[model samples]
Target: MLKKSELKDLVLEYGKKFLFPDFTNKLTWFVAGVGGAIILTPTPLKLIIYNWLVDSANLNSGTRFTLAELAPDAADYSVGVVLIIGALLHNIANRYLVYKEKKASSHDVSGQTNQIDKELFKKFLEDFPSNSDSIDMLRQQDFSNSFNIFRLANLEKFVEEWDTVEREFLNTDLERMRRELWEACYTFNYKLSMGAYDLNGGPIFSCIPDAYRGTDNWPAHVDEKIDELNGLSTTCFKLYEEFVRFGRKSIA
Candidate 1:
């Protein structure tokens, strides 16, 4: 639950968002306010215009002001009412359009995720005929070895798979995973090419690898990288489990 102040702030924020979706909306309301007041209020300018019209009509001898004389009044705010309603309708329309666009974008991302999930399942099945065996293979693998994780899981292939999905279909999570995995793979290759570490070490950062041989605070840096890779590994495993679940449900 929110406190009174927090609730008030939230309400004000949303109200402002609704009323002023953009600068153009602010300008629209400004014009509406000034124009409506001018047209609706019995101001000097309006009276002058009205009197001029009446005088022009009386100048024609054949035409006489025969009706009961009445003063122009806008106390009822008729024009202001119309302007307010128009502004409200415009704001509603803008919000509705934004809502529709976001909904459609969400749907597109969902469809893409489903498609990728099915593809991953198919790939896993191809690698291991038995679903249980496929899962066992994933479970038994070492995640601490970032290189092994990259190679065994064929992270590059999945990264490419994302490329096939339209850019617009890629959501934040998907893009993030792809970028992190790609970086892991790229960093491994870069280190190997630079001869920073020998191939005999198996590219595991269990200790101060050759890459950080002379560097100060290497342990902390290595630990940080290890944790980062560990996170990616965990995310990959969770995704695989989700794929299995999705596949089972689809088959059922």
Candidate 2:
């Protein structure tokens, strides 16, 4: 299990990693500044301009009166239209920029996450023998303690892999992945504990339930989980890609 400090650090780090790319975009400030100025200016200027155009074109009384009252009668309508268009464009552009940023950030985050996963995998592999020995010693002295260690080690491995998957994909389905892996680890451990052993006292293949002991079932289960992860990653990436494409198309 992770320490409180470690979990806190992970949350903070990932939160920042996800948020900073979005916070850096300056389009919002630019739009707000320009929009504020446009909306705050006097309405009389628009009335005067419309009045002049009305007279210059020799328009009828209806048109002339309409132009003269443009500020009072149409000011709200005109401003609403402008604001709507401006807001729509701004949101479209922001989405495109955010999508681009996430794509670039994922590459960097994935690299770091991969490195961490590999390191943890290596550490676990290295310590497996020692862990096995410790388990054996505890089993002789206290079975509960040995089970506790086994559980901890299993959970640690799961966490390491979970982190790796998150960093590698940066998908919104990270929570799902974490939950699935935790459940898988728990089930595996439970089954292992119930299994039988050989004369050498090592767990035997026959010890596991026949449902889990098929020649191909374990590999198939692993593949199925991996496929689920890949599908989630693809979905998030496609979401970003579609947002970028839609923004570009709207501009065109």
Candidate 3:
């Protein structure tokens, strides 16, 4: 009963709530806090060095000594202190960045997982045979009459062809035709899910393969046709599983 725009809005809202700005903000704060802590510790040491130079060494004036008179010991001590501070800063920054990245990655993964779960639930509802009554009601609506009549007519024709195949070639072509029918159904359902057509009328027939009209070698080629259709059906089902399950699990 949900409108296409409503469904889209829901998806966007969930994505924003469970997936975006907050995760990025937390990561930024973590990095800033670690960097600040590491950098602030070096300030006291710098002050201590300045005090020793001015009071203990009595070297208040700028022109009091040359570079050689400064002594390598003090220079070495200063260099060592700077290196230690830089090293700590680098470590903190690296760790913070890595942790943030991992957290963001996990959030993305969980988002994808939830999306797949939602999509599968939708497909289950669509594929359920009992839901056909609801679809029928939708088709009967005044809004549906404007654009969906053609698709409905085509679906009727397709069902008739399906019935004919079931009756005449039940033994030979039934399995193949069944597979094709399922594929057509799946394609139609996917197009609906993507909102590729108007709510009232969609390009369902355009998404389907042409009806089987071959008459030559009807008996001999029946098995081959069935094999081909089954192959296609299997592939489509596999695609569903991959996108709906395996791929999502990988991200999670």
lDDT digits (tens) for residues 167-216 of candidate 1: 32223444454455445444443433332233465533232465655565
Cα lDDT, model 3, residue 239: 40
- lDDT of each structure? 0.53, 0.46, 0.44
Writing each residue's lDDT as its tens digit, candidate 3 over 1-252 gives 999999999998776544333423554445555545444545555555555666645555545542233332332344445555554565566567667879999988768656654554343334432235323523343221223434344333333443443222212232343445545545544433342234324443121212322333334344453444344434544443333343234323
Q: Which of candidates 2 and 3 reaches a greater TM-score?
A: 2
Q: Model 3: residues >4 Å from true position, as ranges?
A: 1-91, 94-98, 101-109, 112-116, 119-122, 125-252
Query: Which has the higher lDDT value, candidate number 1 or candidate number 2?
Result: 1
Q: Report the CA-based lDDT of candidate 1 relative to the real structure.
A: 0.53
RMSD of 1: 15.2
Give the top-scoring candidate (lDDT).
Answer: 1
The reply for model 1, stretches above 4 Å from the true place, is 1-31, 34-36, 39-45, 53-74, 128-243, 246-252
lDDT of model 3 at position 26:
56
In terms of lDDT, the poorest run of 10 residues in model 1 is 142-151
lDDT of 2 by residue, 1-252 (tens): 999999999998776544443323464445455556546655676567657877877655544433436545344445535764675575666578668879999988877755564554344335433245332332232211112333235334544454444433223243344345445444544543443233234332233234444445555554454344334323433432343344233322
